[model samples]
Target chain A: MKKLFFYTTLALFFSACNKEEKQNYSNIAIYGHGGAGFESHTNRLPANSFKSIQKAIEVLNADGVEVDLQIDSNGTTWLFHDQFLEGKTSGNDCFGERSTSYIKTCNYNLGGKIFQLQELMDYFSSLSPKPKVSLQVELLDRCIDHSLLIEQLIAIMEVNNAYDWVQIESDSPGLLIQLKAASKHFQTFIRAPDLTSCINLCSENGFDGIIMNNTDVSVKDVERVQALGFKIALFGVASQAEIKSALKKHPNQIQCDNIELLHRIMKQ
Target chain B: MINKGTAFILSLFLFISCPTFGQDSLSSNIKITTHFGYEISNVGCYGNIGGQINYKKFGFGLAYILDYSDANGLDGPFGVATTLSFSPNHSDNKVINHFINLDYRITFHQRFCTFDCSQKYNKIQELNIGYGLSIKIFKRLSISNTINIGWYLEKSLSDRTGKTISESGSNSLINAKLNYLIAK
Candidate 1:
C-alpha cells in the first residue's frame, strides 16, 4: 500500500508540472492560434476570446487573428471553437448543448470570461483605423441552430459594420456560399478540404481567398493557387519545423501555436 | 524501417533463449498474467493481459493491452497498448527472477499532439530490464511485482489536418508493474 501510494504520489507530482513543450523559435508572420497565449491548452487562456486576440496582436504581433464562432441554444453566438466545451475547458461533455445561462456560470480555467460575437464585433469596431488587425473567423456548424446560424451571423456582421475587417472561412461550402450570397461586401475564404479542391475552389471567382491545411498542400500548390489570383493562408502548423516548411510557400498567412518563437526564429 | 525493426526483434529473441540450448533440466510452463498499472508523465492507466511460455530458467512473453475504450472505469485513463516480455527465471536463487520487457505501444498523449482537441495514439516501443519477485498465493495462482529501467523509441503518424505525417522521438522512463499470474 505504501509503495502504491508512493508511485501514485510521484505520478501526480509529475502531472502537476504539465510543462509546455519547447519548440525551436523562428521569425514568421502568421495567424496566432487562440491569440498567442501560453498555458492555454489545458485552459490557461481561452481560445477565440477578446483577451487572446488582443494578446495575439500586441504580444505576438500577429498581423491577423483567427477565432472560432459557435452559437448556443439561446441564439447567442460565442467565441469558442470545439464541438464540446469539455475538450479544453473544465466543463463537462454536454456543456456544448447547454443553455447560455448555464454556460456563463461555468469556469474555463484561465479563459476567465466568455465573449459572445456581437460584443467581440463591437470591441473591434471601437478600435481606430490605424494599425487595424485583420480578423479571420471560422464557423462551427455543429454548435449552432443550422438553419438560422448563417442568418444571425450575417446580421451581427452587418450591424457592427465589421464586413471590411472580417474574412470568414469554413470547410462547409454551403455556409461559405450562403455567407457570400447574404453579404456581397463581406470577404469569404473557402477552407479547401484537399489540394485538388483547393485548386478547384481557388479557380472559381466567388471567394476572395483560399485557406489550406499546411500538411495537405505544399509550397508549389500555394504558388499555383496564387497564380489563379487568390490569396492563400496555411493553418494547423504545430511546430517550428512545420512553420519553416510552410513559410517556404510564402503564404499570405500561416496559423501557428507559437508565434513569439516563430518571430524570434525569423529575426535570427 | 519495418524490416530492420523485425530483424532486431528476431536477434533479441535468439539472444534471450540461447542459454537453454540442449538443456535437459529445463521445464516448460504456460502463464497468464494480468497487468493493471499506470504510466507516468501523464501517459494514463492501462490494463494488460500477458501470455508466457516458460522453459527452465527462461520465458518468452507477449501481452495485449486494452486502452482504446472511451470509458476506462474509475479514472478514465487513456493509456498505451501492446508489449513483448522476456523473463529470465532465477537459476541461482528461488526468491527472485530477472526480466527484460520489450513493449510496442500505441501511446495516446497530449504532449506529442497537434493542439487539436481530439488526439490519436502515437507508436511507442520500449525495452525495460528489471528484477521481479513472485509470491505463490495458491495452486496455479501467483502475484508478481517488477521495477524496471526503461528506454523507449517513439515513431507514429501525426494527427494532421490535411495529410498524415510521420513523427519520431526518444525518451527514458523508470516504471513498475504489478501483475497477477495464473499458471498451468
Candidate 2:
C-alpha cells in the first residue's frame, strides 16, 4: 500500500503539473466592461451609468456587463471604475474618497453623479432582462475589518436583491476567499494573470472562475483553464485584431472596452 | 511523534546529501546575472536580474522581475524568485556543466481598492524545477541557459479550495543568463 501511494505521488508530480483535452467551443459569453463606455464613439451614454448600461444590454446585445464597485466610509456602494474622478468626472476628487454628501451631489464629466448600487438594481428591475452583470470590486490590501467589508457588500447585494445574476471579481486572493466564505452561492473570481496560478488557486479555493487579460493568455490557455472547470473571462480588449484573436480562442467570457464594435463583430 | 521523527530524519538526510555538504568551505564563488525570459504558453515577456552564491557544487540565488504596461491593460505585475542549484558531477570547469534546480517564486500585481484611501496589490506564489547548462568564457564571465517545469500552489487558493490547478500541454519556460563573476 505504501509503495502504491508513493508511485501515485511520483506520477502526479512528474506528469500532472497541467493537463488538456479537446472540447467543443460553440457557446461563450460576451460582456461589456464599464458598459463599453465610449461617449465619443457610437453610444452617447456615459460609462457605468444607467443609460450606457441599458444601451449595452439592448443595443449592443452583450450577455453581461462588468461594473466597477466602490464602498464609501458610510458603507454606501458606488458603481464607478476609476480610483479618482480626474479625467472621468468634472468633480475635484474621488467620489467615494470624499464624504457621502459630496459623492451624492458631485458632478461627473460623463454626465451624472456617483450612482448607488440600489439605483443600478432598480434600473435592472425595470428592464425585462435585468442585464446580467459582474461587479469587479477592488480589494484594498491592508484594509481593516475584512469581515465587516464582506458583511457590508453582502448586505448591499441582498437589499438590492442582486444575488441571482451578479457575480464578484477581484485581484486579491484573500478578498475572494472571504467572499466565498460569506456565501457559497455568491459567485467569485480572480483577475488571473498566470494560467498555472489561476487554475491552482481557483480549483483549490471556491472561486467560480477567473478573468485573464487578452495579452497574457492564449487560445490554448482558455481551453486548458476551462477544462479544469473554471470559467475563463478574457478581459482588456482594445483593437479589432485583438477581438478577432479572442473570437478564435473562444473563451467563456469576453470583457470588451468597445461594446458596439464587439457587438457588430460578433454578429458578423 | 512518529511522523515528526520521520520528517526530521528525512530532512536531515536530504540536507547532508547536498553537493557542497562535504566540500571545502573556502571554495565558494559569487556571480551576478541578468536575464530575459518569455513564456510562450500565454505569450508574455519579462526582464530579470539575479544574484547567485555558491560553495563548490551547491549554489543559491535570488532574482527579481517587473512587468510594465501592455496594450491589453495588464501591467504592474512583479515577481521575486529564489533558486537552489547543485552541479551533477560538474562543478567549476572549462568543459560543459549541468545543474539541477529547485525554484520558488512570488508575484505581485496592482489592484484598485474600495472602502479605503490606500492602494492594494495581490500576490501569487509558484514552485518550479529547472535544468541548465553553463560554460565559462573570458576567464571571468559565464553564459548559461535553463528550462524549467513544475506545479504551482497559489496561496489561499490551494489552502482554501483543497484542490490543485493544472495547465495543459507544454509551457515555454526558457531563460538565458549572462553571469559576471563578482567574487571568489
Candidate 3:
C-alpha cells in the first residue's frame, strides 16, 4: 500500500513539471539579418564610424551579418571589399598605393577612416537591442596573413565573447583549412564561389553558415541551403531586386555593396 | 482518549465544510455581455463596465474597461459578440447553464508576447464545460454566477504557431452576470 501511494505521488509531480516546461517553449521568433553593402564599399569617414552600416542594419532588423573585413599590408584590419580604391575612394588607386600606416591618413575617400578590428567590436556591443549580428570577416589579402587576422579577431571576440555573435567566413579553401586548425571552437563559414561547390564544401566541412554571392544565387537556392538547417548568407548583392528576393528567402545574412538600398529594401 | 475525540471532531468539520466551500449550482449563461468592469491580468487588464442585449440565440455587447494601475492604460473594446449556451429550460429561473465562448477584443497591432518560446496574444477563446446556477430576479432580468473549467483557444486567429502554447489547465473563470432577454 505504501509503494502504491509513493508511485502515484511521484507520477503527479513529474506530470506537473512537464506541463510547465511545455509552456516555456511557446515564444521563440526566428529573425533574419543581412542584405547587400556588407562589403565592397569604403566608408567616407573613420572605418570605426558605424553610421552607414548601422543605418543600413536598422531597416532589416538584422540579427546577423556577414561583413567583409580586409587586412592591409601593414597588418591593420578595416572593412573593405573592392580590389582597387580608384573610383571607390578618392581615385588614388589606394589598394597598393601605400603601406597600412600611410593609408590610415589617406581616408579611402569613403567618407570614413579605417577602423581597427577592435573598434567594430566595441560599437556592436553597445547597441540597445544588441544585434546578434555575427561577422563573417572576408579575407581579401591572401598573403597567408589569416593566422594573424584570426588571432586578432578572436582576441576581440573572446574578450567580449563576441564569438557568440560573429562567425568567421572566407572563400579560400586554404584559409578555411587554416582557420579550422587555429580555432576549432569559433564558428566558421566556407564562402563558396558557386552553388555546386557550396554544397560539396558545406557537406564536408560541416559549416554552420554559408556565405554566397547574391548575383548568381536565387531565392530558391537560399531556401534549399537554409532547408538543410544551415544559415544562409547572400554575398555581392548590388541590386534592389536581388536583395529583396534573398530577404524573402530569409537568409541569415546578406553581404552587399549598396548599403542605402539594402536598408530601403529591408524597410519595404 | 481526549486527544482522539478532538481529532474526530476536527475531521468531521472538515468533511462537512468541503462540499459547501465551492460555489453551488453550475449555472452557465450564453449572454452577450458588455462588461464595464475592471480588466486586470498579466495579458492586459482594464475597468470599463457596460451591459449587453442578449437573446436566447445571440448576444451583442460593448465594454470600456480601464486600467486602475499607475500605468493608466485604458482600452475601449466595443464589438458585437455571439455566445452559444446550452440551457435545458430557457424559461426556468433555477436552470443549469453550460457555455463555450469566443471573445475577440480588438486593439492596435503590435509585437506579440509569448511564454517560453511560443507567442500568444489575448484574443482568447474559451471552450468551457462547467455547471452554474441562474437566479431569476425580475421579469426579463436574471443574475448568474458560474465557475467554468476549460481551455482558452485562439479565436479569430491569423497566425498559427505550430502548436498550442498553454495546454488545458486550471483556466477557470469566475463571472457574475445580469442578463436581459431581448426576445424569446
Candidate 4:
C-alpha cells in the first residue's frame, strides 16, 4: 500500500509538470490592444503612442493593432483613449475640445509625443509590407461634427493608400452607419456590449464584424456568430489564461493587451 | 535602505549564527526556516519566511510570502500561508526527505493604474495541496522543490473602470526553496 501511494504521488507530479497539447492558431489574427496593450504596471510605453504602435508591429510582430482615434478641433485625427486629457496628459479639457496646435503641445504624462493619425498612415504607407491597423473611433464629445470627422478620417486613409490595410471599429452605431454608407470598401466593426447584442447589432446593421470582450462570450456564442457569416473579434485578454480561453473560442481576431505573452503561447 | 535580497541575506546570517535550543532530535526540536524561492504562477515569484513545529512525522508551519515581478514593474500580490505537512520518511541519516503538504493561502492582489493614478486591490483565497522533495545539502540546510495545484475559493477584481469582476479558475505553482533551519 505504501509503495502504491508513493508511485501514485509520483505519477501525479509528472502529469502536473507536463505541458498541455498545443492547438493550431494560424487562422486567428492577433492584434495588439491600444498598441502593445494598456497595463499601468507592465507596459513600458504609453498606450496609443507612436512608439507603442511601432513596437507592436516591428518588435512584437503582431498581425495588427487596434488604436483609439479622437478628432481634434481642426478635424485632425489623433491617437488617444481618454475622454478628458486631464489624467492621461498634461493638458486639461476634452481631447476633442483642443486644437491641433494645442494638442501637439500636450505630452502624455508617461512621456511620449501626441501623434496624428495621418502620421501613422504615412508611416504605414512607407513600409514595404504594410501592417493591418484598426482605428477605434471614439465619439465622446457631442459638440464635434461627426460627419466632418468621418470625412477627414476617410480622406487621410485615401491619401495614404491605407484603406486596404485599415479597418474601422466603433461603439456608436450612427457613426458606423455613416462610415459604411460613405465607403463600402471600409471594413467597419461594431464594439458590442454583450454577446447577444453583438450578434444582433452585427446582423441588423450589416457590419463587417463584431468586437466583444473575451469574458462576455462563450465558445458556443463565438461559433454561433461565425455560423451566421459574420466575423468575431475578442478583446480584454491580459493574462495567459485569458489568452488561452480566447484562443479556444477560435475568433477571427484577438486584440490582446499582452502581445508578447500571446506570441509566446502561440509559439508553444 | 536594505533591498529584499539584502534583507534576506542579513536574516540568513542572523539565523545561521543563532544558538540552538533543546535536543537535536527531529521530534522534539522546533525549526525556524527562511525560504527564498521562485514561484511559477500568475502571481509571480515569492520570498517566504516561516517557522514550523514538528511532532514525529507531522508538522505545521506559518509563512508570510511577498510576491513580486520585474516584468510588470512592482505589482505585488503578497500572501499569508499556513501549511500542514506530513513526512513519509523522517530520519536524520536520510539524505532525501519527501513530504506532502496541504496549504491554505490568502493573497492580496494589487495593481496600480497610470491612467488615473489609482491603486486597485483585491483579495484571493486559495487552497494548494501538493508534494515536496527536500535534499539535505548541509547539516542544517536543505534545498527543496514543491509543485502544487491551487483551487481558488474566491477571486474578484476591480478593473480600471472600477467595475467589479469575479472569475473562477485553477492554477498550478512550482516553487524551489533554499531553506535554512535556524533552530532544531
Candidate 5:
C-alpha cells in the first residue's frame, strides 16, 4: 500500500510538471496599434473609440497583442499618440499642455476622453490573458519630468504588476536612457525615423532594439542591426508587401494596425 | 510610365485589399516546398521538376523540365519563377489559394517571321491565380490538384500574324509537393 501511494504521488508530480512546461512557450505575438491610426484608411477598421480599442485588445489576446502608451508633462500617463490634446480633443491647439484637468474640461469629439495611465494598466490586468501580451509606451512629451514621470508610472505598473509584460520607449535618446535608469526592470528602446540613426542609437546605448517606420528602413539596415545581436522593432506597416519587405530586415517585433495582416504575411 | 492617379489607386487596392490565405501570427520560421509534375501543350508533353523556398511569404525557386512532342521530338527548358503569397497561416489547408506568381521560361521554339517584319515564337509570360485542392499525403508531402486561370500572352513573328497574340485559358496541373516545417 505504501509503494502504491508513492507511485501515485510521483505520477501526479510529473503531470504538474507537464502543465508548467505547457505555459512556458508560445511563438506568436500579434501587435495592435491604438485604434488603427492611418492603417484604417485601407484596412477599414472599426471605429476608433475606447470601446473599439478594448475590443481590439480582446481580439489581440486570441493571438497576443502589444498596446501603446505615452506620458504627459503633468506627470500623468495616458493612452494617446500626439503630445498635445489640442486638435484631437477640443481643437484648442495647446501643445505640451497635457494636464488631465485641462484635458478633462475640454469636450473630446469622440465622446470619450483619454484613458489615464493607471486605468489603462488596470484594464490589461483585468483581462483573461493579463501578461501574455505586452505594452510599448512611447514617451510623447518632449519636456516631461523624466524622474517624476518614471516613478509614478512605475508605481502604477508595479501596483498592477504589469512591469513583467511592458517595455518603455521614446523617440528622444536622452529621455529613453533616463527612463531606463529609473525603472531598471523594464526593457527600453528608442523609436527613430531613419535607419542610420536607429543603428547608431541601438549601438551607442546597448538598447534592446529600435523601432522605425517600415517604409523608411531597408533590408540591409535591419540585417546590420540583427547582426549586432540586437532586436529590431518595426512599426506603421500594414500590408503584405510591407510585411514581406520588413521580414527581409528580420525584425524582432512588428507593430501593425492590422494584426490579421501581420499573421498572414508571417505565416507565408 | 502609368499616370500617378491610376497607379496610386491600383497600388492602394493592392496594398490594403489583398487578403492572405492563412492566419496571422508572429513566428519566425522558413518553409521549403518542392513540386514535380507533367505539362501538355500543342508541341508535346513534358515532365518537370520544380522547387521553391518561401521565407515570410515570399518565394524564390527554379524549375527544370523536359518536353517530348510528336512534332518536335524532345526539348528542355530551364525556368525560374517567384511567388508572392499573402496569407495569415496555413494550419488549415485551403482549397483556393490567392497568390500572384511571375514565371519566365527560356525554351527553343521555331522563330516565325511576321508580315510586319516582326519576330514571333512560342514563349509564355504567365500571371496566374492558384485554385485547387491541397491534400496531405502523409506528414511530409502534399499533393495539389489545381487549375490556374491565367493570361497567356505570346509574342510571335509571322507573315500572317502580329507581334503579340493573347489568350485566356484554364490550365490544369497536378503538383506533388514535399514540405518542410521550420516553425510553428
Candidate 6:
C-alpha cells in the first residue's frame, strides 16, 4: 500500500511536468484597452496615457490599441477615460467644459501628461515603417457639439491619413449615423449592451461591427454574431483565464487590459 | 491604521501563548505546531505562514498569506485565514495523519489609484472545505498537502466611474505545508 502511494505520487508529479498543449491564435487580434487597461493597482502606467499607449504598441507589440477620446471646449480631441477629471486629475470639470489651455495645464495625479488626439495621430504618421497597428477610438460624449467634434475628427483622420487604420466606436447611434454620413471611408462600430441589440443595431444601421464586454457575451453569442456577417470585439479581460475564454469565443479583436498576458498566451 | 500583516503576526503570538482549554491535566494530548507553506489557487499563488493548536482529534489554526503570482511586485492581495480541522486517526501513532478541514479567509485587494488619491479596498471572503494528509518526515517535522474547493464572496468598492467590478465565483486551492511540532 505504501509503495502504491509512492508510485502514484511519482506519476502525478511527472504528469504535471508534461508540456502544455499549444493553441493556435493567429486569427484573433489583440488590442490594449485604454492602452494597457484600467487596473486600479496592478497597472504600471495610467490608462489612456501616452506612455501606456507607446508601451502597448512598441514594447508589447499588440495588434492595436483602444483609446477613449473626449472633445474639449475648444473642439480638440483629448485622450481621456473619465466623464469628469476631478478624481484622477487636479481639474474639477468635464473635458468638454475645459479649453485646450486649461486641459493642457491639468496634470494627471498619476504623473503622465494628458495628451491630445492629434499627438497620437502625429506619432502614428511619423513612424517610418508605419507600424501595422489599428487604433479603435471610443468617443466619450459629454457636453460637446457633436457636429464640430465629427468635423475635427474627420480633419485629423484626413491630415494623418488614418482612415484605413483607425476605427471609431460609440454607444450612441446618433453619433455613428452622423459619422457615417460625413465620411463613407470611416469604419464605425456600435458599443452594444447585449447580443440582440448588437445584431439589431449593426444590421439596421449598417455598422461595420460591434464591441461588447467579455463577460456579457458567450461563445455561442460570439459565433451567432459572426454568423450574421458583423465583426465582434470583446473587452474588459484582465486575467489569463479571461483571455483564454475570450480567445475561445474567437472574436475578431480583444481589447485586453493585460497585454503581456495576452501576448504570452497568443505566443503559446 | 495598523498594518494588516503586523496585526496578524501579533495575534498569532497571542494565540500561541494562551493556555489550553479544559483542565483534564492530559497535557500530552495538546500539541502546538508552526507551519509555513505555499498555496496555489485559480486566482493566484500565495506564500503562507501560520501556527496551529491541536487537542486530541481537533485542531484550530491562523495563517497570514502574501500573494506572489502577478507581475505587480508584492502589491497583490494579502489574506488572513482561520481553519478548523479534525483528524480521525490523530492518536493512532501511525506515520500518516489524515484530516478534514474547514477554512475561512478574508483577502484585501487594493485598487489602482494615484498617490494621495482616496484608494478603495476590495475585500473577498472565501469559505473552503478540504481533506489533507500529513506524513511524519523526522522526529518533529512533517509534510502535508491539502486540496480545497473555495466559494468566494467578493465585494468591490466603486471605481472613479462609480461602477463596481464584481468577480464573485468559486475556485480551487492546493497547499503544501512543512510543519514543525513546537510542543506536545
For this target, which candidate reaches the highest TM-score against the unseen true structure? Answer: 4
Question: What is the lDDT for A42 in model 3?
Answer: 21
Q: What is the DockQ of each candidate?
A: 0.02, 0.01, 0.02, 0.04, 0.01, 0.03
Question: How high is each candidate's TM-score?
Answer: 0.50, 0.51, 0.44, 0.60, 0.46, 0.59
Each model's lDDT? 0.55, 0.63, 0.47, 0.73, 0.50, 0.73
lDDT of 2 by residue, A76-175 (tens): 7778777676777766564445566767776666466667777877776766556678888776624223455567788877777777788898888888
lDDT of 3 by residue, A82-113 (tens): 55555545534544333676656655453555
lDDT of 5 by residue, A114-220 (tens): 66657666666665445333455544556556566667766776787665676666676776676566565656667776777777887777667677788877778
| Weakest 10 consecutive residues of candidate 4 chain A by summed lDDT | A9-18
Candidate 4 residue-wise lDDT, B29-131, digit = tens: 4556655565654334566666566666887876666664433211245677788989978886898989999978777754322232343445667678889
Residue A198 of model 3, lDDT score: 73
- List residue ranges in candidate 3 displaced over 4 A: A1-49, A57-66, A83-100, A132-146, A218-220, A236-240, A256-268, B1-184
Q: What is the lDDT of residue A153 in candidate 4?
A: 82
- Sort order, TM-score high to low: 4, 6, 2, 1, 5, 3
Tens digit per residue, CA lDDT, model 1, B98-169: 555555455433222223324333344555555555555544445565555554544434222323333222
| lDDT by residue for model 6 (A1-268), tens | 5744554455455444434588777788778888767635435366788877765565455667888877888888888888788988888787788898989888887667887888888876665434333344445444766677778888887887776788888888877888788787878888867779878888888888899999999999989988899888898788878888898898999988877566655554
RMSD (Cα, Å) for all candidates, in order, is: 15.7, 20.9, 20.0, 14.9, 25.4, 14.0
TM-score of chain B alone in model 2: 0.63
Better-scoring candidate (lDDT), 2 or 5: 2
Query: In angstroms, how far off is B110's CA in candidate 5?
Result: 50
- Ranking the candidates on lDDT from highest down gives 6, 4, 2, 1, 5, 3
Winner of 3 and 6 under lDDT: 6
